[model samples]
Target: MTPADLGRPRTPSAAREQITTDSRTERFRARIKMLGSLSCQLSRASDLDELFRAVYSELAGVLELNAFVLGQYDEANQVVHVVRQVHSGTELPGGSFPVGNGLTSEVIRTRQARLIRQWSIDGPRWQVGYATEAEGFAQPESGVTVPVVSDQRVVGVLSVQSYRAHAYDEDDLLLLEATAEQVSGALRNLRRSERLDSQLQRRVTELETILASMADALLIVDASGRIVSLNRAAREVLCIDDSAILFGKPLSHVQWREWPPAARAVADALEPIIEALGRGEALREVEAELRADGRRVLSFSCAPIHDEAGAPFGGVIVFRDTTGKREMELIKNEVLWMASHDLRTPVTAIKGYTQLLERRLTKGQATPELVANFVGVLRGQSDYLVGLLNLLLDYSRLEAGRFELEPKRIDLVALVNDVVASVQAMSEGYRVTLQTPPVIEGDWDAVRLEQVLHNLLTNAAKYSPAHGLIDVRIEADEQSATVRVADQGVGLAKSELGQVFKRFYRVEGTRRLEGTGLGLYICQRIITASGGRIWAESSGPGHGSEFCFTVPRYSRQIEQRCPRGACCWPSPACWEQVSPRLRSRRAQA
Candidate 1:
């Protein structure tokens, strides 16, 4: 009575307790293994779609399921794509659905799992958004829909359905909810990777665009001396064509040197770049200047580029075309030299001569012939100095846009004769010839035009040798009259023709010539202001030159209306009859 009665109820209760403890332990271990398996599967997924499919296939072993579909929400488009679906019994709809209408939508909206057992075909909840014809589903079904939530927000939904009602209970819902969390994390991570990749691609495109649009040359070379990147400006400066690129080509390769035309200067410019690559370390900036053409000057710089750790990776070259700036600098230097030498020499000479004459006269050592000869010498030096000063002053006035013209009508042919007569009277040992019609005329500044002719005659006479014949030709058309002054003198180089009008520009090796460089420049300015264009024609040095300029013909109406005896050119209306009667006076005396 003692053993049987005492152990009966206690023994049965203990057995049940141990059984419950074993069941809980087994379920816990199984849940842990399932989670580990799911994690392993998701880790191998490269993209979101692959993750979706992985979760779809992996969750089947962990849960009681008949039909499954994983839906991802596109909140932007308000649509959901059924990324993965697996079923053999009840047929579901195709691959997309509107977000706010289905059982899956309810879970996303609430961030909760749904256990809908009574799937009445005509029920209000099921009938409203049902795709019966498209889904081909037999009703009276049961299912559980769990939202895949991340950071407390639903990103998508995972669903499983069964053909019988009351197919799932609270424990099944618990397992599905726990599995939904892992799925959400995997999908989130995949999405983040995709967004990062997209941003990287966008940045790469922007960099390429920026490099292509740059105006200055930029070149990037690798540590191996191979060209990696070159901008549009680099290609243009190097004269590389569009049919090919410099990429992956070594800088020292013989063909690459020729690629840039290496024309004596470009070759020198690339030398530093080649050396920088060979050094394999950061290099100081090396500069190069190139004068390929007479007009444009190119400047280049090469330097080694280093990474954040101060380790040298490769090198870069930057090129700037500074033609205008170099030309301006050359002009400035020339002006400075002229001022220091030409201007100072004449002033100093005049001062010295004056001092010497004053000293001799004070000592009473001067004779009458000596006084006259000294006076002539003094006068000549004074004139020369004054001419130099006048050139500088006139050039500055013209540059500052202050030179003015006083207009009057005059016979240009008469002005030429006057210039030739005056120049010949002043300078000897040079013969002058005139070939012109007597009647050609224009509305011009008579004094200034005469001065212009005199300057040209004087310039020709100064450059010519003894007994050299200076030919002056005058021609006219309806719109303008032209004069040509030809000389037997040292001709200008072809390059000098365009530059002769620039202030302080002189031919190479001609600094020995006695004169300021402003003569031709002033002549051009005067001619341009008088409504004309002027230029010089020369084959080359030692051949000879012809200086020519044209002045526009005066309107007949304006000339005819002018008051007589005041100032006016002989209007065509007045000259038409007389021009035919006057014979050409060609003189070579």
Candidate 2:
């Protein structure tokens, strides 16, 4: 129990314990400083490969290592490229190295640090480049490799070798791991930035393709009012062949330079609209007329387009040629006005004469027979003038798109009978007859339907030779009713049938017959507006012609209740009773 035995098994004193703790703390502090320095260097590098190179070179100096190799991962190629190499006081050729084999693969797969104290002890397991292996043996084959990982996924591996066995202690391993983590984070950031740049490029290409495909001229201007882009249509419209005209040119300069006055006005007014659009305002549209070279008249419209944040980016203008349409409108207005004036003069004259005769008769200043004869002539002329005015009004209403029809159930037989009676009074030398079915009920506008039948009958009377027959017929079944008007006049020539229904169209060969040339056109318009179609057929000139139209039929009971009574158009085959031989032949056919 002397002092030696009582000294607690000869353990070191507090001074020695304090020294050991201080050494360990110093080691930890050094490792931390190394990590911070390497991280700073790697972070400053711009891309993944550059970061890997910086991290490898900086760590080699901080650790005082002899030789090192950095293999940066290429995810697409599934290979690692030797991004950096350092051999203290030595030279080693640098190149890409495979990751599928040896020490690098083991570290990446396990995400762990590996150390070889001596190459002789485990040289067979350390397969690297022949140049690297040769350099390793010169340094006693002592080395350490640490996996660079981010988010628990190993991205690359960092390897450093020393010239002495067990040259790297546990503190060195800890420092290498910290540095690898920093390098991994920098690499991930670099990759993300690259992907964003690629996406932005693709979006720009897509926008260009869309603008090029647009049919209207497109021009894009920057906030500074300079032209940034223009589409193919713009180039053609501006008559500029080179793309140099668009880029960096002020929008106002290009818009006004050598442009027409109307185009200039449109461009000037559109600038503010584009500015408003940049403020996220609603797009503005403006129309202007442009006539540059007299080749055509153009109607132009400009509209503002906006950016993603709702700022006005630029404007789009469209041009449409309207020269022909405007000219046609002017011609139509003049012709109708003149025709109306011509009609008024005749009407005034007839009214004055008729009123004079009526006054004389009222005063008993004329004989009964003489008064009767004069009155008859006056009435006929007045009626003729009234008919002309009615025709003109109908044409105007139809052309103006304002006509409204009131349709009701009509008797096809009664309609034809009324039309024939009117035609007979107008032309005593012309014989008119109606051959029809028992009865037919159809939906029709009474006034318009009557006009159609009257026009057909009047035309037949005027064109037929003296005592010639004009046949009218009504044919019907459950679905439809057809009215046929056949004239034993000079039939329409083959070339005339197609043009008969056109406005102001008349057969020149039939000039002997007087007409306004609007009769057939009016007839066609009336029949079509009443939910029916009309057409004419002729065998040849002088062989006679037939006009037919079909209307949807109502039941016979409806005809009985109709206020206008039963009216009908005889069916063509109804003539069988009038012509036994023709009926027999038609039956045989």
Candidate 3:
């Protein structure tokens, strides 16, 4: 053979086979290059829509396309979610379908590739769902469906179909399978990223909710002392409406002079804590006071935040207003002092008088007049001691939730008049006037009502100037009765009005006066337990004060006593008069 003939196959059949082999090799190389390019495109895709477009474009280059479908398999529900569907180069609406008797379902069920060469014979065995049938077009004759698997599990399916018979060969099937394998990895990564993003967003929302709801002021700072975040309470404590002015600013560089006086004082107090944070030190329960707005006390804690490796990354601080607590402490101390002194004075007087009487009797200087005078003095001291002791005992019982009321029908107007007369007899300079409807009866504890009136009148007498006026008035409505006791006394300040009802709380101006500070508190407790409300009102100091309370005219206990079909009165209007027993007793008198 010649040199040129040596390069060629010897027989005609061999030469033709060689040519076919060369063509196959070139097609294989082109498919490999296409797969590499597709992988690169998928990696660069920013979203699912972009990834779907890339996949469709790459697959179209190598396959006869009449319809293309991409779906994610939901194994738990035994269904596929079609993410993208195209028919005749036109996009179609995508939806989900059950894993029924269909070619796509078979591929997903077997986790393998399916090749249908001719629709008339093979399509009937594995029928297509309504999702696959395109209206106004001939039925598909051939198709290829492959499972997109990852981690030994099928996650999705990729499919292509053609209207012509024998359209796809074994080579096309292999190419589609390889493409599905690459897509499996990319799809897995995308879903994983989406799950992580959803979890992170949920965590951030929960954190924001907690911070907003906190009552204590919270502040977070980075390692460089730059402010990272502060809660609503922190902004309120700093006395700033907008917190944007403080974000990303170093704590030490804040303009204290530009802040309000109260905020400036708070900032000054934080300086030492800031320095400690810089030194990586933790501080707890550090208290400071600001006198700029009356008096405000703050208790704060600071700690260094650390990473998982125990390296310091930043710091956090939480503070709360403690002015009420500090005031309570002061009030407690003052109450203790007053209790001790008041108890001792009565005891000392009794002791001294007893000693004096014993000495006089031993010296044979006792006379009836002298003994009588001494007895009177001793009796007065003993009564005073008994009253103080009772006050303390009542307070303790109320605090322990043991104080109870005995309710009965009573004339409120008569009770008030009696209390006024008794107080007037004891008080030399005060004149009390009553303006109330005659015989307005209510269901209340008579003894407790008397006690309330006695305490209020005595308080007015104690705090009033000589000849001060004490006015008592009563009014009634369908549901309740209101009583108001007003006195021209050393009235309470606006701030003290709310505080006066607290146990062991006395107005600062009234500290020098004689009291255990429990009378008003006990009054409030009694009124509240009777299904009522009590409050004090005053127009600042030295302007007179009024204490008003309301009680239900007919309490539950009273209703239980006078049930339906067995009552003394026909209607609630009958409560405007005294009870029959009282009326009869008055008539006899």
Candidate 4:
């Protein structure tokens, strides 16, 4: 009171101006404080949802926010998604709405702050639709809606309301506009993070899918030698049916699993890969094969895999079944040795005979008859050599998988009669008899089949005693035509029956016979390749053996399989006119 008395009196306008100035300064400080706190809050918000919550929290700090809708604007789609909504003293639901629907739309379209002294969450005055329209939610007495602008464009809308009329003033509008920039920053950051997360997930799925489909049985181990991953083929190759047993097991325990004989043999062979892990070494294509009793049964390889920094982490173990390859190699080696020795014998004999003939002529001891006899012997040896060469050529063609057939229709009866006649002329002792239907016919390779028949007949004569008889039967049915060559010769043992068709195999006593062991093998190949099977039947040794085979038979009623060079048929289209029943029969044949 004493200080007031001593002070000089001023005009009312001056006092009023001073009070106004103080009030403005206080508001400016408060505004600065609110904006600063909002920036800090947004910086710490984790995602769009948290930032939305932060925006409303900041608004509550500076003004009365009774109700609000925080929406993301999609201008291209002309829609507003009310991503978050909060209200006091009213029930209102948030969702998508058309851009031009209400007060929220007004702020988005004009890109300016909007004020409505009185507003409803529903009805004609409130244009934007909400989920609470059917719930009869109350209206806001007053509100302010503003665009949340960032980077010179509006990204979304921020609206606040109060239950009291004119609850939001100019000061509230200014504060909300300033705080919206922080919200905008958060939304963009969150969207970027989500996109990155989605891309990462997709890449992981692609990698897993690729690893699962690999053809080779693959196994992956970690730095600690723990089994971490395996493919479907691994389960098959290892003969394991359960994944739980394999996924977390150690590489050291692979041999202990109940592996199949083949897999166990591989695990035993792959010791090199296991030892490399302990030595901190990397291996690539470490080829290995597993064998039992000195015979290769399986083959496989191992290679190390590296991590991101090129550090050794694991290895890939791959396996394969190589039984067929091993068998083929053994057969090929045997064939080469036998062929060389067999071919050399004939050549060596011919050389010796020529030398003797030359010496006899020079010594004046050569008679004309002796020279003629020597020439005849040479010719016979040459013919035998030619036959061997031909057999070898046929074997080569069949082994190389390139044998071809020229099929034609023929009277199998005529073929049997002609072969028997030829055999009778060549050999004096063996009497060959033929039994057949008068006109049994079929599709067959004439030249090759004739060779097959000739081989059977000659072998029969060669193995039979002098004056032995050979019975030949040619028979046909709806399905196939069969040829039986029964010889009264030294028959085969039970074991010899199966071995007779093997390459380089001959009966025990028949080794001295004038025939290479390749004849029956070649005949088997030809007969089997022509869609027939050849087999031998016998009681026991010295009794006799019957060699029988079958070739497919088709109806000769409408279609006859004609020869390649000469067609005995009237037209090539004769097959097209066959009856349906015959067509089905031929197709089955």
Please give the range of 10 consecutive residues that has the lowest summed lDDT in model 1. 580-589
Residues forming the 10-long window of minimal summed lDDT in candidate 3: 564-573
* Model 2 per-residue lDDT tens digits across residues 119-162: 66854365543344444435446778888787777777788877
lDDT of 4 at 430: 80
Candidate 3: which pairs clash?
none
Over 1-589, each residue of candidate 3 has an lDDT whose tens digit, in order, gives 4799787757888778878999999988989989999999988776677777888898888779988899999989998999888887877767999898788888888887988899887764765533344354366789999999988988899999988899999999999999998888889778887888889988999998999999999989887778889889988888867735787887568775467888877777877776677778899999998898888999989999888998777898889999999987886677677679899988998999899999999999989899999998888889889989888888767645456565678999999999999889878888888899877887888988788889988988888899999999999977788999899888888888889998777776887887887888888877766667788998878978898888877666444543321112223223323255543543453
Off by over 4 Å in 2: 1-34, 37-46, 65-68, 72-100, 122-124, 130-140, 162-167, 242-245, 251-283, 295-589
Q: Give lDDT tens digits, candidate 4, residues 1-589.
A: 2587558787899789979999888977887887888788788877766777777776677678768788888878988888878866343456887765577777777888876665553222654322344556655677888897767777898888776776766777787777776677777777777788788888888867876787667767666667777777777766666644766666447555455676666656655665575355755555555554355655566666787887767776665556677778887887787778788877888898899999999999889999999897788688779988999898887676445554677878888888889888778878888888888777777887888898899888988889999999988887688999998899989988888998888898887765667899988877765556789999989998899888765434213333221111112323344345544654565
Model 3, runs deviating above 4 Å: 1-67, 74-79, 86-93, 97-102, 106-112, 118-142, 149-155, 162-167, 178-202, 235-278, 354-379, 392-406, 417-438, 460-513, 517-589
Q: In candidate 2, residue 30 scores what lDDT?
A: 70
Between the candidate structures 2 and 4, which one is better when assessed by lDDT?
Answer: 4
Question: What lDDT is reached at residue 491 by model 2?
Answer: 86
Clashes of 1: 1
Tell me the tens digit of each residue's lDDT in model 1 across 257-353: 4553444456456766657655864444344555464545666666777779977678887777777777778876776778678877767877887
Greater TM-score among 1 and 2 belongs to: 1
Measured against the true structure, the TM-scores of the candidates, in listed sequence, are 0.64, 0.46, 0.70, 0.69
Cα RMSDs, all models: 11.3, 14.8, 8.6, 8.1
Candidate with maximal lDDT: 3
